[model samples]
Target chain A: MKRIVLLVAAVFAATMPAASAAGPVDITFLHAMPGPLGQALKQIVDGFNATQQEVRVRAEFAGNYDQLLQKTMAQLAAGQRPDLAQLEVSLVPRLAAGGHLLPLNPLLNMGNWQDFWPVFRRQATLASIGGTVWSIPFNNSDPVLYYNRSMFDEARIATPPATWDALLEAARGLTQPGRVTGLGLILSDIWILEGTIWSAGGEVLSDDGQHLLLDSPEALRAVDYWARAVREGTARVYPDIQSWQADFAAGRVAMGFGSIVSWRFLQPQIRFPLSVARMPYISRPAVPVGGANLAIFKDIAADQRQATWQFVEWLTEPAQQARWAGLTGYLPVRRSATTNPQYAPLLNLPATPSLKVGIDQLPFARPRPTAPGYVQVQVEMRNMLEQILLQGADPRGVVRQTVERANRILAEEATR
Target chain B: MRKARPVQDTLVLLVTAVFAAPLVWMVLTAVKSQADVYMGPLWPRSVHLENFRLAWETAPFGRYFLNSLVVASVTTASVLLTSILAAYAFARLRFAGRDWLFLLALGTLMVPGEVLLVPNFVTVKRLGWLDTYAALVVPFAASAFGIFVLRQTFRKLPVELEEAMFVDGASPWTVLWRLYVPVTLTSAAAAAIFVFLGAWNALVWPLVVTGSTAMRTVQVGLASLIYDQGYNLPVLMAAATLVALPVLLVYFAFQRLVVEAALQSGLKS
Candidate 1:
């Protein structure tokens, strides 16, 4: 037994050097992407591996977004952080501000970073720490309205609502006993609130990105509008966004706002025709840019950094981005890919008529603030909103208190 | 009494049905088409048997099942042995500051697992056990809950039997091994089941510690099966069914033993 163990150990030892020597650049790439997009990402890595011999990129799906953050933080403490991390936009500031990320500009300086879209660039280039461009946008998407076309046609609610008044009217018009709801309000989801509030010309954080602005007129109008829908029976408030999607597919909802990526997953399963449109705007046409950016960890070795950069650059290329967008509903970061012949067919899917709405809203997209305390800020805001919607509290007063508490949290961070 | 028993049984049945509703819904949906899963009636019109096959083929479940089974088994075994020894030492052995020591062990239960995550991860990394089964099993081998439960059980075991063992020239270790273990098997079984279930279903820690996909357990594998673009829900359900099957089988097989042991332990204590 000992000799066999020794023989196995000797073989493993002999192979280790060769395995280490083969890649010269094997970097651990961690991501929070689940489902088909996760598979698509692995395929992208495989493509890169096949196309080049210089780098060996290993892709890992790190569960969900929040759990990924915790995992990354733990790994950072353990000094085994990944070479590249697909961090959500909300978490970028916290990770970058902690000085755990390497600026993408250095990597971009070596290549043509301008090949990417301007909106995507802005979302990623917020100068995370000491004016450093910490990460680059990869899987950028905006929330869009997905409606069952058959239900809309039956109700004569054409063109899917473009303005807030139209949205409320259509929602009310679509409601019937033992029938579908006009809208599904995922009151428990912070992302829905962020997108809706921002569209109403409200900023989640102050202009200086230093304070919470929930009490601002824009936020107040947004909250009031949302509350009216819930109270007036135009929308059915769900406890969670996950449950809402399931309900929507069952014809429980007439219209719902969700990530464009949701369409790829949801469209395949729905029996009826689906229509997509820009998420209804109130004061202005705006949407919060969601999804994640690819970030390099500070602990990555210098040589491995180059390999990771090579993979990142290759993966974000127009062809690859277009292919990724086609496979996944996430909008391509590269502009040229939208008009690509291959993606045109995907965009023309009968169910996803307005799939491009997310990409179209990109020019008017507002990214979440890059403040260090933004994650906790959003969670607290979601909690406050849930209290108002589910528990039937006064929205205006609860929002006021939430704004105050958020500002205090922001203020504490400012001094720190 | 006979007249009331049927009513009681009916009430129990209703409660069980209410509790089992979600699991039943999940299984039914797994065997139904997309439209039938959502829009159709409660009972599926037809069962799509391929969903289970697809779900099984989607990932390396064979390997994941083995990994889960081995890790859970080892963890349960180690925890049962360690908790018994530690509990015996605390409950029966005369020691200095034993109460304080017990309090210290109990104190760890108050600290949320989230806070220790980073420290434990760093310790495991330093020990170079990442992606290995040891990473999943070792840190959790000494469970405070197990110790507490077993200690309570050990405290209630009769002192007369221990004294009789001492008179028969049995050492404290022998007494613990022969008498305490046999007497507290029920409590130990309960503890083992709890630990086994927890280890079998752990998500975040295992996902973080195990770097390689090959080393991933069923829970992580299932999550991985649901890709970001979309999930094959039928397959997801099928895989869920398969994963749940073993647990159900184990529970039903040992349920009588489990109940009898729990009753005996509670009554004796």
Candidate 2:
């Protein structure tokens, strides 16, 4: 028995190193990419795994952005949070304020920060939350106008609209009564509304992020344009955002406003010639940059956090970013990625015209409001817009009441 | 009255068709080509059977289905065992604080499962059960509704049955298995179906507990399909059809047990 035990101990000691060498540090990365975007993200993750031996990222699809947020919060409260997660840009304030995210300043200093676009860097910075950088930008996008070139040509229009007044003129000319609606407005999210408000020279919140500014004259003017368009039969608001995309793809709507990432899905479905253009402006060109960012949770172990940072660094490398942008329709977060030789072929695809328009508009892209209670504010804004466009509520009265309610919510959140 | 019978049958058929139309539409859409999906016709221009292949390839649905099956079956079997024992005690055994304990168990019904998500998650994490089959199956092993229904059914049985079993020198375990279980199979089957469906269709708890694709259930797998394949209605519908097929089959196979359970309970009253 003594001899057998000694032999077993020797065998166990001999094999331990082999086991440790083959087993990489395992890390979980929760994300909300769906469909083709999910596929593209998986390829990137798989690529990272194949290239490394020290870290293995287990990517879990945590539903859509809202669902991912809920899961992350619940897991954090339970003390079993993933090492890393993909968070929507708007969620930065709430997560950082709650102390759920790890500040990325130490990791960002390690040579990845300088390559990011200034816009993305600013979006990732949380000034109100002690100026700690909380996330790294990924899958960034801006809303652009998706128009049917055939419809424009049939209307005797030579070019897509460049301003709000021209948009109205184009809508009037493109409206075919029973045959085709001129514009299909998506009332589901606040991205388009933010762009409209910005174009009319209004801010969703005050500079300090403590007040609601939707009741301003600029915002009212923008909403009134939407209301008049809907009332005049030149525009229709779908019950859901996806229906607008579907109608646009089916040639039932002449123009639609959606994320530039939508090109990956919409390009193959449209039977007619599709044209992409900048979002029609009002006083000046302005659009809100929308996308998700990678946030590491604070509760993970040191080694796991290190592994996660390594994966994040690899993900943001110029070559990887170019490949990711080429596979997915999101604008490359790094400016240097566009000039990379590998991205040249991607830039020449048929979808490049629309992508170019989005890239050109990037200079004016502003981050969505990152106030603590901004999600509630978005909900109120959507409800107000829906009422004004669909129910014909007076734009001025609805905007005033909505802003008052939003301000009350923000104040309540502040006290908490 | 004879003429009214046809009209009544026609109305019932119409209602049934109305209830089944969405499922029919899903199957039809699942078989449609991408272009035909949006063409607004009930019938497809050409059937694209490849949608199922594409949907299956998109996610690890085979693993998800297997995980859901194991979780559902294990949970249902455990729920049945625990519920039967507890119900027998409540219905037949007389002990101190028996009624109070039963009431306490019943009180748990008032608290919604959603309210317990965080605390339960914490408990599971402390046990180091995250991303394990135990995390999926253990927390849901016993159900209050199952106990309540079985206890009600057991109480409705005559006391003479237990007396006879005792007089015959049978133990409590034997009495439960030989007498109570045989007579209450219908109610047990009903409880089993409820537990099975609950476990199979669960999304939030499984999604919360497991953080890897290998541990995901079919419900989570199907949800991921929506974000990735939301544009391709055919593939989305095909995946939905696959996820739902098991539950529909289970319900169809056990529906008679539910009907008989309702009838038996009614007759006892």
Candidate 3:
């Protein structure tokens, strides 16, 4: 028995170094993307691994954005952080403040950083941290108007709405009492709320990130418009994203606001001809840039960090961006990606026109508030919107209370 | 009492049916087409078995099942062994600070599992066990709840029986395995069921420790199905049905023993 044990131990010891030497450097990439987008991300990672000799990237499907944040924070506290993560843009400032993310500016040398659309570039910049670029934008998207063409035709609307007033008018025209609601708005997400505030010429946070600006008249006007719409039976707020998406796909809603990312998933399910339009503006066309960005954790080995940057840079390349945009419904972050020969066929497809509209709206896209307490603020905003839209609370009073609560939370966060 | 029998039977049937409705709905939804799902029909217009096949192909569920099986089985076996030993010492053996020590073990029941997530994760990482079966199985090997349950059952065993074994020159180990364990077999089985279910259904710890698909358990795999496939209710329901099958089978098989064990534990205590 002792001899056998000795032989087994010797064999195991001998195989250790051989295995280590033969294996590529393994790095973990945590992401929250699910479904077709997740599959597309896997393809990109597989492509990178096939061409590389040094680093093998493993794309892990961490739950959604909130779950990803929780897991990453837990891992960080445990000293077992992944080499790379895809974080929401609004979360970058908080994570960077925690000293959990590595600054990419020092490692980046190849890509034309300026090639990124101005909106994406601004969103990816961590102004609180010496204005350094901390993450590379990936799967970037903006809200657009997804209207059922058949419903629009039945309502005698010749064109999609171009302004908030026109949108309300079209919504009112499409209502069929108990049969179909005119519009479905997702009240749970802060992205749409921020976009509405911006379109109404109100900012969510001041330039210095010290105070709330939603108490302005423009912000109140936007909130009141949505509240009145809901109360007037022209629009209904769904409980969650899936509920609203299902309502639209089931022909229960005529028009809805959704991210461009919804196109790939919703296209197959909807039986009607779905048309996309730029988000209807109140004063000027402005939508907040939404989606995730690639962030490298600070604790990875230096060589692994270099390899991670290589993968990030490769993923953001014009050709790769075009491929990703084509596979997923996300907007390509690079200007040259739209003109790339490889993507020309994708751009000519019927489904690409809506994406074209999304692309055109990029110039007017705005970044979400980057306050460290912004996540909590988003919850407050959602609650306030729910109160106003669902409970018939006075819009102006709710807006004022919500802003005051947000400002207090920001103040507490500042001291921390 | 005889006249109340039919009423009791009817009430039982109604409650059982109520409890079973969601499971039946899940199975029905699993076979429904995506378009047929939202139509609010009780049954699919046409049975679409393709959702199950598509769900299986979407992720490596076979690997997830194997991972969950191995982790859960090893964890259950370890828990039984450790709990039996600890419970025997507490119930049968005379030792210094025995009561204090058992009290300490029971004290852990108050700490929520969620509060230990970060600390346990850190300890596992420090032991170089991240992404390994050791991370999933070892931290959970000795469940305090298992020890407490087994200890209660052990104390309820007739002390005269153990004394008879001792008088017959039987070793303590002999007394435990040969005499005490047999008498408390039902309780042990109940403890095993609880431990197995806990290990099988665990999500947060396994998700935190394991990053590779190769190490992910079925619960995590089922969750990932929802992230991308939330709109595809049929596929999601299919995946969920597949994940719940093994646990349901286990429960159905030992349900009589489980009920007897529960009644005995409560009555004896």
Candidate 4:
């Protein structure tokens, strides 16, 4: 028995050094970005795995933004949390506040933070809770107006609309019964609705993050103006985001307002000539940035934390970032990466040149407010918006009630 | 009873056909080419059997099949053992707050499975059982439904069996093994099959805890394929067909046993 035990111990000791030499730290990373973006992530993981003998990073697709939050919460509760997760830019505050994520500031400084773009630097810095950088920006994209160019030509429109009035006129020109609608607006997606609101110089919440500003005149006017497109005979509003995308792709809609990352899926299937332009502005030009950022989960072992950091840092490198951006249609986060010679030719490609439209808007892009209980609050807000747009709920009264409810949610979250 | 039989039969057929339509479409789509899929009608223009082959080859479906089979079988066996022992005690054995304890066990049925997800995950993680089959199948073995159903099955059994076993110098375990289990096998089979399906198709917990592809079950594998590949309808349908095949086969093979067990368990009390 002693000899057998010694033999087993000897075998284990012999294997231990080889495993450590191979950098045997394994990391689990969850990301909301899927399809081409997920493929890009896989390539990054493959590259990381090939380059090192020690740390092995594995990528898992954790559904879309809302699902990722649900899955992550469950995992955290189960004590089976991932090493790193791709959180939406706006959800960072709650995760950080809950002490579920590790702040990236110390790690960033240790890893030479000079190469990142100023916009990302500012945006990432702002998203952190209590001046702690809990997440690093990845796959940041802004909304753009994608148009079926053949439909535009058929409607006798020369160029895409650059202003709200022109957009309205274009919609009027494009609308045809049983064939097509002018603008495909999804009433259920609050982010799209807020894009219109922000473009119209409206605020949904007070800048302090403590008050509800939905009752403000500017906010009311923004809603009323948005309702005009549906209220008027020019266009149709979709009950959900999927229908909007489907209608646009099926040639039932002349224009679609979606994320720049949509080009990854849209470009591959579109049979008609497609073009992109900046989303039309009302009072001011504004586009809410929507995409995910990579954050390290707290409570992991130190080596696993290092492995996670290594993967994240490598992912943000100019060459890999540019490649990922090209593949996924996500705007490259690093300024140098966007300008890198490697990306220029791909950006110049005709079928997907539209990707540059969103890249150009990064300087003006800002994130939605991140707060605890935002998911429940957003669901209520979405229901309210959908009710007004689709169900013909009283816009003024519903808006008032929603603001009150949202404020209550904020107050409840504040106490926690 | 047969006065208006034709209309009722037609109506029943129509409803059944409508419900079966999606499954039929799934089968046809699985064997259809991309062109046929894009054309998008109720049926394929021509069969493209290569889709199933391609989807099967794309990942480790063979390993996934084996893993799922082993996990489901182990889970069913464990649940049967635990539930039978617990159920016999609850049904026949006298203890302090026995009724209260049984009620508490049954009361857990009211709580949604999602609420227990986090605490169960934490328990598994603390035990360092992540990515292991034991973690996936073990905790879930002690099920409330199993205990409740088996208890019902045990109570319905003639008390003479237990008395006879005791008179012959047999203990509870001996009685349980020799007589009780044989009599209650049908109810136990019903519970085992239900738990088997739950464990086989489980997504949330496995996706949360396991990191490696080798550790993934068929459901997670199919989900990841869809997410990774851009809406390739043919390939997705093929993958779905593959995932459904085992469950379908199991049902067909034991259709008689399953039905008999289910009816006996339900009608007993």
Return the TM-score for each candidate structure. Answer: 0.92, 0.91, 0.90, 0.86
lDDT head-to-head 2 vs 4, winner: 2
Kindly state the fnat score of candidate 4.
0.24
Q: After superposition, which runs of candidate 1 have C-alpha atoms over 4 Å from their true positions?
A: A1-23, A107-112, A340-354, B1-7, B226-231
Q: What is the lDDT of residue B81 in candidate 4?
A: 86
Give candidate 3 regions above 4 Å deviation: A1-26, A52-55, A78-80, A106-111, A340-342, A346-354, B1-10, B91-100, B156-172, B178-180, B228-230, B265-269
Give fnat, all candidates: 0.63, 0.39, 0.33, 0.24
lDDT of 1 at B179: 97
Model 2: per-residue Cα lDDT over B146-230, one tens digit each:
9999999999989897899899999999999999999899999999998999999898888888878778899887777775213
Flag the better candidate by TM-score, 2 or 4: 2
Residue A402 of model 4: what lDDT? 90
Output the number of the lDDT-best candidate.
Answer: 2
**Local distance difference test, candidate 1:** 0.80
Model 3 C-alpha lDDT per residue in residues A328-363, reported as the tens digit of each score: 768888888886667766444455556777888988
Per residue, candidate 2 scores C-alpha lDDT tens digits across A216-322 of 88988888888888999999898665788778877789998878777766666667788899999899999888788999988788879889999988888877877
lDDT (tens digit, per residue) of candidate 1 on A1-416: 99999999999999988876765578888887765567778887898899978888888878987778888999888777889988888788777777798877774564556756777767777753566677878787778888888888888876878988889999998887567788888754576677677878887776556778888788888888888888888888876656776878788888887778777667757788877898788878877777788898886777888888888888877788877776766778877777667666644434454456776777777775767777668777878878777788998789888877777777776556
Instruction: Summarize candidate 1's per-residue lDDT along B1-269 as a digit string, tens digits.
Output: 34568888999999999989979988998898766766678898998998887777666789999998888889989998899999999999998999999999999999998998999999999999999999999999999999999999888888999999999999999999999998778788788778888898898899889878678898987886665434667778888888888777767766776897767764753
TM-score preference between candidates 1 and 2, better one: 1
Give the alpha-carbon lDDT of every model: 0.80, 0.85, 0.84, 0.76
